[model samples]
Target: QEAKLWLPSAVPSVSRLTVCSVPVVETEIKLRQYRCFESLASLRHYLSLWTRIVLAQRAKPRSHHWSTRSQKAFSSVRERADDTAERYRRDRQAILELRGRGDWEQRLQVLRNEDVLSADPGLL
Candidate 1:
């Protein structure tokens, strides 16, 4: 013979495959599947607690409670509130100024002179 090749006479067969469970990973998966709170009361309690915590953090929101995006969102909300307050102030001042004018002042005087208690509100 010029050449010869060696080969196994018997072939090995796999019987069973065993899967090991990781405790930490299994626990984490279970935790994710679990319900957040048992009852509505507990949910409400935690919400109130979180509200208090958030309120406490409002003064200086540089803590872990606030992320950069959340801080920016709160800042925008604050800015909108300030803008609304300023607008309301300006509107009230304008209304007051308008009421101090001739016809409006006369009408207010007439209403004041009349019996407000007995006066028909619809006509006024």
Candidate 2:
């Protein structure tokens, strides 16, 4: 049949043979190209949970005595969380700037050549 004859050509044999597993690093980097709504939604949900926790903890009566160490620990935790969120924001911005309608396949291939994904550390 005509379909049978064309099927062989349609699926390039070389591409099949060359379909080796991508390195773990390259795999993660390339996966970022695909939009993930579920992850974004989950992140938003977690952020909301953290906000609620902060509010609830604030409403709770503090022990009559507050230790300096406890205050320092709480402050450190909040600062670390803020820093993490800022890093994600910057990373997203850097990725957008690097993309600028560029070809993902080409960009991925180039990235694989070096351990570094982008000159900008944000992509890391």
Whole-model Cα lDDT of every candidate shown, in order:
0.35, 0.40
Best by TM-score: 2
Write one digit per residue (lDDT tens) for candidate 1, span 6-121.
Answer: 11111111211122234533443233223211222333343344344445456566756566655565455445434433443343333333223454333222212122211223
| Highest lDDT against the true fold, candidate | 2
lDDT value for candidate 2?
A: 0.40
Task: Give stretches of model 1 more than 4 Å off.
Answer: 1-53, 56-66, 101-124
What is the Å distance of residue 94 in model 2 from its true position?
2.5
Which tens-of-lDDT digit does each residue in 49-68 have in candidate 2? 44544554567746645445
The alpha-carbon RMSD values of the candidates against the true structure, listed in the order shown, are: 32.5, 14.3
TM-score (C-alpha) between model 1 and the true structure: 0.31
Model 2 CA lDDT for position 106: 46
- Pairs that collide in candidate 2 are none
Once all C-alphas are superposed, what RMSD does model 1 give against the true structure? 32.5
